[model samples]
Target: MRWMSTVPASDCGRAGTKSSEARLQVDAWVAKRGGERAMAVRARARLVELVAYARTRSPYYRHLYRGLPSKVTELAALPVTDKSQLMAAFDDWVTDPAITLERARAFAEDPALIGRPFGGHYSLSTTSGTTGKRGIFLHDARQWAVTSAMATRMLTGWLTVRDTARIAACGGRTALVVPDDAHVGGAVMAARLRGRSRVAALSVHRPLEELVEALNDLRPAVLAPSASLGVLLAGQAEAGRLRIAPALVCLGAEGLPMAEHARIGRALAGAKVRATYNANECPFLSYSCPAGWLHVNADWAIVEPVDERYRPVPPGEASHTVLLTNLANRIQPILRYDLGDAVTVRPDPCPCGTPGPALRVQGRAADRLTIPGADGTPVTMATRPVAIVLDTVPGLDLFQIVQTGPATLRLRLAPAPGIDPDDLWDTVRARLSGLLVRRHLGHVRLERASERPQISTGGKIRPFIPATTSAKP
Candidate 1:
């Protein structure tokens, strides 16, 4: 009987071991209590305490909060601070004065050093800055624990009660499909699943054929991918190539459009499709409720919507910009950080009955583009709307395309290095042109910029901005 019990062959390599039985057991423990109000209560208490600490320890915040609200609740009445202020005082914003921008950059740039904390237990990760400037942030051990709990809630919430059981029984294989490089989320996901031998890390930056093949073969029970990538995979699944019927599909990093959501839902054949609101500036902001409504974590973070004057907007009104205060992370206290993404809190209660506030998020605020039709009419394409089509483009990572003219366009593509720019341009041109007539393709120049692109207030990425409009502005 003892001899009959042997090591499972699936628990072998680094990729395979990423989703092991041991990790799955831990995941079960986390999932069981991840969603309770008690968790949020505990997290909020810690967060309020962290805020007080930041006010004392952080040089930047110490001065910023000089006038002060006596209590943490007074934070809502205070003026909102944008990214510019926090970034301008980059050196003094964090609790640890020793962790400089240079040190953060050095650690983030080194692929080998990722997942290895900065000083003992300090984790570092940077945002893609769909706003203007990319932001670097830090997390400590306690923050990591809260982050883990939040992640469990987001990931496991996608699974049905039945699916959760199947996941546990089938050795619980999970797969994280993202870039192969050291993306902070990818690094965290990889590190979390390191002990799980059944988990596989497949790179979305790979060719479509390769990515699809790997997915069909892996048959991962827990499938987590970016919203755009998930839509593209859904196309493949509809085409009958990718065959895995995942129990859960957790979409993150970018907004999941309605069309793409339906496509993925059909492709997965009743598997739960959900959104995770996370930015490098503030990770684990919210999760999709069982009924598909996004519920703010309100536990580790506070999401405050502000108007033009940085005053709190009414519950139903969309915010001009979002201000976030990250609670669990004291190593780098993020208070009133202006996340360029636009969001509106829904006035009504969620059907899912989650106590947290309900929200409707718009995609990146920088990538909004508009183009002129062949009929001498302007066809406005919002980034959030076109994200449905962009979801189909394979191996496409970060990108920004502005229409230089009706027929001419300037494209800024941050594709995976070595990918053919011509192919991406051709694909984009075809999509943009297919909607318009007599539309001559312009000089789709591929260049790199120092900053990440932004979407407009229209809640979309401007894929093609007419050259004529900028001249007037």
Candidate 2:
């Protein structure tokens, strides 16, 4: 707080742009090779520093940590947090006074402000309703620099000398197959990297044939897409319709069966497919090794697998959910925030030889929808972008999508109290049909199921169920 007080809040963002990135990158490089002990030292120092600052600067945290000591090094000493509590008190939750919940939401909804900074120096992004509620986040330049540096460290760990040569041979072009919307993280990243690097964003909403043609022409050296979309492209490549030779197939995916990964590798033949586990909440959460374990980046962030009672689950056991604390993000400090994903920490050291903790996550993989196109051919779409469309619908307490056949879907939903279920269903149908028609699937039939949305054995309700699912819709 003292440091922030020295300069005006608006000017503080500008101060941390270039110099902060260079410094953080250097620190990341050191932490990469410094081993677990070194990382623990840094993590301890950052934990104490951030906790102190958050308790003093953030009004919500100030009251929450009222009785705690001035310095908090142990993460458990802090209470757990989630989206609902913080979002409800959003105006007082942030450290900065300039940010308001309504204005920040308005800024996030504006498509023109996608990659542009808010308050001239903050990165703004909105999350989908996958967690039963939406979220809006802001990252100042300092936090953005740390996120960039952490991602760089992961890239260097995944790519080898041969892969580097392959990237260079193809003019270093990179294509990210993601939804072309401001609310999407991949698009924000692609937009941010335009002049700094060679990157292209191919929207999954485009017709299947068009997406394949665009990839054929780009022939990017590095291709990154959602796991399901990558599999779809693998099929196209095997059919000889897509012909790009990528040295690295980086999947922005997690919790997928190893067979799906192998299928892509077998189809591409020479490309190395790397799986990553990331969320809009914490972008640099973890990355995968050849041993198929996700390694957590614990130097600057804390990951704790907890049970239903918020007790720390022992290693080698699966957890009911996980908690995340982002030491890098100060503008909106995420301290022991409930991320709502199941993960298991490995009891032994990983075979990959990295000293960091290894984890196995569950319930992060989503189903893909294959609807029949107007021409009789089937068109498969990743559930992610489709989520972006449905998440925009307002006033629904619960909703679910179930694909019954090639051209038919069953919808299950519960409207919020005092709202008309029919009106909400109409909005859902119209928006879903609009999305399908835009993707050339106007012939797809939608049905409103009499049954309500059901929870899985995992104790959570999935927003979308695939055609092969045994779950009743």
Best by TM-score: 2
Give each model's whole-structure lDDT.
0.60, 0.77
The runs of at least 3 residues in candidate 1 whose Cα sits more than 4 Å from the true structure, single-residue gaps closed, are: 1-48, 69-72, 154-158, 168-170, 365-400, 403-473
Residue 182 accuracy (lDDT) in model 2: 52
- Candidate 1 Cα lDDT to native: 0.60
| Model 1, position 53: C-alpha lDDT score | 83
How close to the true structure is residue 360 of candidate 2, measured as C-alpha lDDT? 80
Instruction: Quote the positional error of residue 255 for candidate 1 in Å.
Output: 1.6
For candidate 1, lDDT tens digit of each residue in 260-349? 676787887767677778776667678877565577776557777877667788778888778887765677777777776678888877
Candidate 2 C-alpha error for residue 44, in Å: 1.1
| Best-matching candidate per lDDT | 2
TM-score for each model: 0.72, 0.90
Residue range 222-272, candidate 2, lDDT tens digits: 899888788788888889888888888888744667777777887776788
What candidate 2 gets wrong by more than 4 Å, as runs, is 1-15, 374-378, 394-398, 404-406, 413-424, 449-459, 469-473
